[model samples]
Target: MTAHGLVIGKFYPLHAGHLGLVRFAASESAALTVIVLGTVFESGSHERRADWLRAELAAAGAELGHVEVLAVRCDAPEEYGTEIAWVANVAIMRAALAAAGRPAPTAVFSSEPYGVELAARFGAEHRAYDVAREGHPISGTAIRADLAGRWSEVAPAARLDLATRVIVTGAESTGTTTLTTALVDHYRANGFAAMPVVPEYGRDFTYELHAETEERLGREVAMDDLVWLPEHFARIAERQNELEDAAAMACPLVIADTDAFATELWERRYLGATSDETHRFGTDRLPPRDVYLVTDHVGVPFFQDGWRDGEHIRADMNGWFVDELTRRDASWVLLRGAPEERLRYAVRLIDALWARNATFASPPWRSSPPSVE
Candidate 1:
């Protein structure tokens, strides 16, 4: 008979220790189920945590085969060591398992003392691993208390979602790419090993479209020759968001030359109004952004890199960005002056953004007020 193993936790933010526990359980069972229990108070939703769990398991490259992830939401008061709370939690877990079509687990694995009773309630044997902090020496609480300091302890899958996303947007030849590269370099030099910059996907899309049009016409296609479509802008916006998300997974600091949100502005600039399809694929799908850096067109000569419009419309383009960003009440900084000067101010703004991201909101379970130093 095959033994089905179960591991459950809040995974407040999945960390290395949680991975270790799940890994150990997977090794011992024919099939394993990881339950990501969530609460209304948690910042990460149950589905999001499950995504993180799936990503980490998938990264193990078959070492964690036959493992499934599910989620259970429980908002009952977390009164530790109380019979009422334990019973309530257990009922929620059983209901979730049944709803998910999972069988009764033969073994329940956990690092908490509650594992004993949790297993008993399900008629499963309790298998405790690393009851002490010897193996990973980290907890969700500790990780939450100092998220940035313990960033390495966080599971690789969760890091991407938690990363600070900085997006740079501007009119043609306004140094958006220049500032993006500079900020990425600055972070890498400042010890951010995995700082990655997502290049503008719109340009890539435009190039492909231009090439395709030229091939069809059997002639060199001018920038105007490329016909823009609402669906085309939607694709660009969606891809831009995808690229940013993928780059964010590599490290905590992710810089994007442009993002899905920027795609909407580009759509309006070309089409006279933002299409429903573009808007749907743009800001609606954008990941939470820390700040938007708008590069100023002043003093920057347009290079007209063959794909770009002329300098005459550069101010108009910049104005669109400023107006839209202001209307949305989004956090943004206008970068101006020479490259070096622009970089200096950009660094200060990003430093503040990084500091703010590093500060984790206190979990709702903590009843006492935080001590002020």
Candidate 2:
């Protein structure tokens, strides 16, 4: 019944210092569980912080089998203090372990002011590492400042990937697939790695819905019986995760055909209506992008694929795409022309992007790195 060690933190942007502490804890304990404090503030969501922590851990070789990442929501104002926060955190951890039917932890790992006091309450051994001299201590305040446009002072580890993974998004047959493929090829030919987004589960699920709900006289179609009124957003979320993981493994640039944002557009347009859940998901679930390539109406002919709507619907979808991009405050390049012409424009835009950007330094952990394949 001896439990593993626990490391609790907001980990707003898990940097080198946090990783060092985690590694220290892991070496000292039988196992290490990183408890990420969630819902601490309305500024950044729990999911975003958790994702950032997971990726940082992965980069630092701490995402091994022994380490577990868990999130606990702490929305109450009282949960921000030392003792109360520790009690709530311990209770949450116990519940989480019980739910998983695992042994309770025997130690708590941290370097914050409350480390010893918090450990005492659980009757667990406490280990404190000094964060002041550990690694590069780039705090959340500094990171937010950098993200607000002060890039020069940002730590190297805190910077985003120089060459971004951009997704070309739109409704069905809005040239997303075509543009994505062309961009990948263009980047590859120019001696850079650009991968098209692999179609995720939602596309397959949508295809299935089409096959079931509609009859194909000469083409595939979704049946009317299987409408979008009762669609679940879980499929979109699953796909988004898959895409993110794929991009992480990819080379300099990863181009996605469509993302969760595109799915939201379709759901709102075709489904009965959008709800608070859908809106929140759209607001939070979409990945942050360095740049967004939006294809405006280029008078391109709409292909009548099984899932595709008509020209009028396509135009309407374009408006929705613009609106969503505006809402997100994303800087975008509006590509307009025939499919091939649009492809050419995308290539030019990419050229501009690369010209203005610096080369990406190879991540320390990546071995046998991918080339433009």
| Top lDDT hit | 1
- Number of backbone collisions per candidate, in order? 0, 8
Using TM-score as the measure, the top candidate is: 1
- Number of clashing residue pairs, candidate 1: 0
Candidate 1 lDDT over residue span 1-373, tens digit each: 2399999887768888898998899999999988887767666587888898898888897899789899778776665568887788778878888998989899999888768877898899999888886998988878777675677788877887788888899999999999999899998888686666699988888889988999999998788888999999999888887788777766677888988877898888888888887898766667878889999999997897777878998899899889888898889899889999999998898888777766655446655311100
Task: Give every collision pair in model 1.
Answer: none
Q: Candidate 2 regions off by >4 Å?
A: 1-163, 192-196, 200-202, 212-223, 352-373
Error of 2 at 299 (Å): 2.2
Off by over 4 Å in 1: 1-10, 16-108, 112-125, 130-157, 360-373
